[model samples]
Target: MEYEAIIGLETHIQLNTSSKIFCSCKADSWFDGPNTNICPVCTGMPGVLPVLNKAVVEKGALLAAAMNADLQPVSYFDRKNYFYPDLPKGYQISQYDRPLAKGGWLEVPLDGYQRRVGIWKLHLEEDAGKTKNENGQRMIDFNRCGVPLVEMVTGPDLRSADEAAAYLIRLRQLLRWIGVSEADMEKGHLRCDANVSVRLKGSETFNTKTEIKNVNSIEAVRAAINKEIERQVREYERGGKIEAWTLEWDEDTQTLKKMRSKETEADYRYFREPDLLPVHLTEAWKSAILADLPELPLARKARFIGEYGLPEYDADLLTAERSLSDYFESAVKAYGGDPKRVSNWLLNDVMRMLNESGKIAGELSLTPAYLAEIIKLVDAGTVNTNTGKALLDKVNESGKSPAQLVESEGLAKVSDAGAIRAVVEQVIAESPAEVESYRAGKVGLMGWFVGQVMKKLQGKADAQKARELFEELLK
Candidate 1:
């Protein structure tokens, strides 16, 4: 019997705010020592009160808008009651009933088609601390306590593991593009928990689902969910019922271990948070926050395809990052030529350089203007294509303009027909045997002749002009 997996992901994103959600302690304690970034307000001490960080609300709203979620006019926080060692407050201050925003969908491009995943919940919450089970003992770190997070849950609209991973990929791109979160899975900035259930392909009613946790990377998410789905299918085939267990993924061994029974919403015992006031999102305030939202990744990618006439592959590569996309647009405008030419240079050469140097497109010393000028020089035959490529490295290293470096390094193209004719004649005179073979119909030797002329001219000669001269002189 064929079975389909019903998959949904709940992602917790750490907002890039300066301070913790409700306290002045540093929000990002990724590098800090245990409990160093904590204060009375975040530490859950006796008689302490919580204060909402205005920046958290603003950034959360910005993400909500980007996700196409409906921003609520009035939202309230709730006390999510749980008793765990890492949760010092004994209850997490989160939004349960009235979250910041609700009801939205993000369009995800799968292998061929796009699927719109509905957002079941999008709310602001405080993060719990970390508990590490080291060698023979457990160590607790509260540095992550009170860290601001926007937890979003997706509907079970995904039918396969690949679709789930694609959703996370696009979500991470959107998060970073909007400048809201770093969304780095390795850094724990963005984490995901996938809930998976497998049922007969034609059945619409839900099956007993188990939740998988501790998947730190997107690849891990894909592998773990796939593994779980297979396990559930086998169990049912043997006439065994699937259990509702919270499973932990063993990334090292590539297996899943039952952690505990899955907890229900009633287990949370959620109630309105008593210490803080409800968030009143006024029209003007909401408008001001949404104003900061930039063009999302998908929208910009579509625009690149429609407006610039770029192929889907080129558009996808260029729009992978916001700065890279913007760089392409600026270069296109400055060059006033084929956008595909600029796209080719960026995807092949510029992207390689950026990766090697650990920099983004915006951080390049070769700005969009410099890039446009270099391509223009190639177009006008001011520099050969090889010399033009060298200029990219030279200009990036010295932060000099393309024209200045071309002049200083004597790298201009030798387009003079007479000058190229001299080199072509010298090549024919030097390689007599090769020249005879070429005239005797070793036509492939034409490329070798061009290479010889280019070497003599120090890669400054136009290969096209060299080829023409070679054909003329050999005849």
Candidate 2:
């Protein structure tokens, strides 16, 4: 029998607040020395009480609004009783029964259709410290302790590994676009725990599921879920019992190793924390956040397709990053040329440069006005497509405008028919054998003749005009 995989994700996002959730210590402790950012409140010292950061709550509300989640006017923190070397308090402060948001859905594109994945809830919590084991000694850094986090739990609405990956990518884009979190998987700003199960394709009852913890990257999330699904299916087929467990992904081995038994909700022993008061968001405050919400990725993508006349694929790519979409708009506004042409240049030349330089669109030396000029030149046949691309390299290296570089370097299209015909005549005169072959019905040599003329002109010729001149001169 064919089996279908049921996948749910619990994603933890580190908020970008200036201070820790319940303390005034700096929140960005990723690169600091061990425990430098720690204080009495985060380190769980005796008699030190925790206080909520108003900024965290406001950012959480912004995220909820972006996700279309219902923001609960009242929510409170709970003590999730657990013991780990990194957790200084021996219990994490988190939200339990009354989370900050609930009942939202994210729309992801899958198999040429839009699928809405249900968001079970979003709760605020504090991050644990970092634990390092070196040479048989264990070290714990409390710098990350009390760092603000929002855990977004999704329903078991995803069916396959691809769908889960797609949902995650879209979610990250939304988070970044809304400015709530950087959601950079590499830096631990966003992390995922995937719960996966498999049953017969038509069966509705869920099977025993295992949780894959701390799959940091999107590629790893996809691979880990697929591997877990396969393992469960094979075990069930062999008449072996599938038990719920927690596993960790070993990237070097490309395998999942069993960590421990999965913990149920009761295992945490959650209870309301008496130290912190309930967070009550006023309607006026929520309205203010809602009004400040920027255009989300999906909405921007739709607008790109509708207003810019871009294809769905192009719109999807252009709007994948907020900076890239902004760049596209700026170039179009400055050039006032075909938006599709601007998109093609960005998706091809600009993206290639970004990848090679390991820089984001906003960090590139190529300004929007310069890129607009390049597009305008290509559109006006001042330079052919090939010359235009070459100009991008010069602009990046010298920080010169496209027009200045093109003029100084003589990269302009050789559109003068008189000058182009002279090069065509020289090419034909030098290649007598090829011209004879062409006249003898080897018409495919026409392309060869055009290449020779373009080479003679140093790729500065309008290719179409050169090709026409080649045909005329050869006959």
* Top candidate (lDDT): 1
Q: What is candidate 1's lDDT per residue for 1-475, written digit by digit as tens?
A: 8999999999999999999999899989877788789887887899999999999999999999888999999999999998999999999999988999999999999778999999999999999999999998999988899999999999999999999999999999999999989999999999999999999999998999999999999999999999999999999999999989999999999999999986664588899999999999999999899889988888888999999899999999998999999999999999999999999999988998899999999999999999999999999989989999988888899999999999998999998999999888998889999988988999999989999988999999889999998888888
Pairs of colliding residues, candidate 2: none
**lDDT of model 2 at residue 233?**
90
For this target, which candidate reaches the highest TM-score against the unseen true structure?
1
- Computed on alpha carbons, the lDDT of every model, listed in order, comes to 0.93, 0.90
Instruction: For each candidate, give its TM-score against the true structure.
Output: 0.97, 0.91
Alpha-carbon deviation at 308 in model 1, angstroms: 1.1
Q: Which ten residues in a row have the lowest lDDT in candidate 1?
A: 261-270
Q: Provide the global lDDT of candidate 2 against the true structure.
A: 0.90
